[model samples]
Target chain A: MKSLKALNNPLSTGQKQLDLLHKGTSETYKPPLFVDTIEPTGHFPMKAKGVEVLQINMGKMCNQVCKHCHVDAGPDRQEIMTRATLELCLNVLKNESITTVDLTGGAPEMNPEFRWFVTEASALGKHIIVRCNLTILLANKKYNDLPQFFKQHKVEVVSSLPHFSARRTDAQRGEGVFEKSIKALQMLNAVGYGSGDLLLNLVYNPSGAFLPPAQASLERDFKKKLKDQYGIEFGQLFAITNMPISRYLDYLVASGQYEDYMTQLVDAYNPMAVEHVMCRTTLSVGWDGQLYDCDFNQMLEINCSGTKNKHIADFDLEALENRNILLDQHCYGCTAGAGSSCGGEVV
Target chain B: MSKSYYEPSDLGKFGDIKDFQPELAEKFFGYYNSVFQEGALSEREKSLIALAVAHAVQCPYCIDAYTSTSLEKGSDEEEMMEAIHVAAAIKGGAALVHGVQMMNKAKDMSM
Candidate 1:
């Protein structure tokens, strides 16, 4: 059996990219293991406890081509959920006390059935979170009304904004992406998505080699500046750490930042932040309905237990709850410093 | 002709070696330094860009370092937050365009 790493080759770009999907920089660049004697600068619990948030990967259809995406999501991917799989999800939602439904993908909105799922979840009174890539709203005519749609259904908009500068944003994404993202954000604001008192949330992750700043303090700064400069009002700013996976690992390997970056994460590992790690409370569902310990694990193809049904169709809350987490060095990222997730600081 | 399947994951072995093929790592490091160097962009500017690029690429370590570096280099909160959207857009768009491949294949098979 080929260990996934056995399949990689530095010379081939395609192989390199695929390898990145499974072995984020952590595997290759060995960071010092988190030693207990060193007092952790930031606080987080040592072990993770499960929470009731239900995460679902709608599909792999997206509109942007950023460099660091972990999903390997693109327009060509066909691994979408069938109506049957979605039905299984709804059944679980009805029976389970799950409070949050997190929808992801290559811009989950690209799914043909995205709205149907969102509407169904809303009807069930579940808090719906759409991990939106803001520019999608401005890419095509079909997506023009997404802000209105999200607002109408009261779906919490967890959108990403890499930075405030046009040059930096455009370089990472493409030429005109900054202008378009701003337009879409303004649209969301117009529809009350980011206006004060609205439930709109903007996600922030660093652009380069380190952990994020303290979430609360960062959010304060974000709120004030966005409000003052662009009049872009958002409810909360989530400072998530970028997990080393997929294209990102490729970027790290290609640019030789993999080792130093991994070292930084391991050095910053804080056990106190572990308890609040999103994986403890959240169960990530893949596009094919497979169950993963967390989104990062899913990308690595580490599914729930050997005997359990990994797909959503086979969702068993009790069985999943009993399964131990699948962890690795990448887990350090979630436990470092103040910790990071879609909701800001974990600890 | 879209190569369709180019993944960096193929290069996993390079990182596994205790002492990497220094020449190779050096090459990558060189490109990296060049990417972040002060040219049209300042080191501070490059750090912010790197932070957003880190998210676009999804490297947790880069995310951790660049986030702090960006802030340290005077990137305000709004600026850093905005950089993430840039990553999201490119990532999302990359996924969406692959649909063209699917569409082409579907059309070819149908025709």
Candidate 2:
């Protein structure tokens, strides 16, 4: 892992990147703005329908630097949720309206108090989701029992396995990631995690600059390949579109695919998908307890679109619900094609 | 004014053909739309075929459009490139097969 300061310097200087995106959205190559495209469908300025899911970005400290990671999470990242912030989240969960807690991070498991937070959240009887990177469970001896811990809590584990093949997965993520991820999946399966009662969902984002194949078709391929090759099983597979932000944005710019990719996203905007976007139902809590409409907005540092109650400490359900979700060019990623969200295709 | 045989911007204005011959343009567009629609072949399968034809005909506009279309329709790079190779094989084979005509003509002349 590189030093945190070194890894984050580019992000601090990323205003140029943002400007490039802005130019695309506002000037040349304009398809209708994402918000405008949805307005006629009565879904513009997208508001939270309800807080059914509370997605907590535990921190930016991750075990690997995946190329398309919108979180820009890597081993060098030092951001971790403090116990105090976790307590605030737990307090919010007491409301019962938030029925699910979706935990994400560089690797949510890397947080020192991660299990404690999960244990307490599970006691609330709410469905719990952990966006596991798979490799982290195999990264260290202390973290090896993550599968058992998750099973005990009955946590729904959603992991990224970009492809079932080693070459593609390792290309997007780091070297040997696919092998470690397979081992982690087998370990989870051994504990009955992928079978009945325990839900082990695998996430697939494209390895290059393209939308994922239809979730149903891709899931069949994953099921056959994983079962035939490694004798693995899982409940569901989620096909996620790579959000054009953070490391992926950097890749787009560097590879000269930024404009074309954004054009594709804008051109493929699906109004039907706008109504069910994750941001409509999920409140993303950042590492420091700040709030955003979704995790991609959190990475771009776009706060929730409101004048008040922008942090978990100041969480007011009514006020938060009434606030308009922020809009930007990046919003196209969520609305493109079949529509994309943490749960996979919306439409 | 400046002049060039092919203007990159012309691709975006493809719909503007209606301004000249409205009925014919409309008919052409209708035919084009129907052609791409699913029939015996799926839209994805058609897009792959269009991509292969784009390369064989060396039409930059078709190449650009069908490449993106194929991707949107869920074709991976490997499959898409393989489609191009299929085009390449036929193209190369067509030229080589014509050599038999030249061989016969040369033998006749020499005799």
Candidate 3:
């Protein structure tokens, strides 16, 4: 493991983002008591309902390192999933009754065998969902044809567009990212990816330490703006609340807003949102094939609640079905407002 | 009960309004709840509006409540501060506009 100082020093764009996330995890600031808030609402020890979506973190190699990325993924980080791990994930998907296979990463498409894995997963007659950073498609010549490839595989592409405007989008991502992303979306649109059956979902996470506006309203705004301004189209807009972990955590602490943000999340805790949380119906697989309740937990290095069935290779459906969904201060992000998930607002 | 006109701690006791007049407080709290729900404006939009109103009214209790409420509803610091400025502008403009009346009165008296 690299030391914190070594990984964070020289403060490149990605490194600065990494350093912020690291600084957030320091012991100086106390996270609002997460369990106390939930327990009082009789939603303590949140448990999984069943596994419907198997979300896999393909790798931590991404082109653009967004400031609020929870994965802490970047170009320098070389933690790609091996063929062996991919095989194990496939094996589980093959045998289990899982309906959706959601792929995520620094950019899942960055993995060398990303296409191969998608091909195999698609062959399994499963609903494949890829969490793509649209800028990746325009990052290099080799990746330029990714939109067509996604269309070929019938993969549901869920890309993050922080805001509709370039100024705000580029501010959170990087300079010129908005332009590249717009081009990529146009490419996807050209291939009918956002049309009738080919699902193209856009995700909206707040640029700062705030919850997103209502998903339906934001979706309408995104649809109208993208159509009129850029002649772009998409299926749905998922309004996601930024989880207080990783890069975002670093941001809150650096700006002296960590405590306030946590308090806000705690205050907005909606008991009704607990039952429909993605963790209840989804399982997250890390790059190394370790199983977690959700992606945020995987980032925090929190494994599944139980001692057994911790790895995807040793996946036991029964053990996992009974496993308690791990809870932490970060869980507040998911339960707040209408609730947040990979599928967007749960409630 | 204390010497100061405003007690900082009273902000936390906002719910204690019921203790003074149960019927009116109940009705007021009920209306407040209905006002904040998602409808024509989202809970988030309402929070921002509330934060602006809090500043305009110069209510310390409402300022603290709505500031947190605005953040809870997912309004960023930039947006929150902007909302405050909107309030400040309106409040300042209201006071400034009243100067026209003073000017008119001075002209009449001088004549």
Give interface RMSD (Å), model 1. 6.1
- For model 3, the superposed segments whose C-alpha errors exceed 4 Å read A1-6, A9-33, A40-44, B1-111
- For model 2, the superposed segments whose C-alpha errors exceed 4 Å read A1-10, A13-18, A24-33, B1-111
Give each model's whole-structure lDDT: 0.72, 0.86, 0.83
Q: Per-candidate DockQ versus the true complex? A: 0.03, 0.27, 0.26
The digit string of per-residue lDDT tens for model 1 on A140-247 reads: 899899988888778888887766767656655667877887788889888777765458887777766556765665676667767787888888778877777765
Better of 1 and 2 by DockQ: 2
Clashing pairs in 2: none
Q: What is the TM-score of chain A alone in each candidate?
A: 0.87, 0.96, 0.92
Global CA lDDT of candidate 3, please?
A: 0.83
Ranking by lDDT: 2, 3, 1
Residue pairs with backbone atoms closer than 3 Å in model 3 (clashes)? A20-A250, A211-B74
Question: Residue B23 lDDT in model 2?
Answer: 99
Best-to-worst order by TM-score is 2, 3, 1
Count of backbone clashes, every candidate in sequence: 83, 0, 2
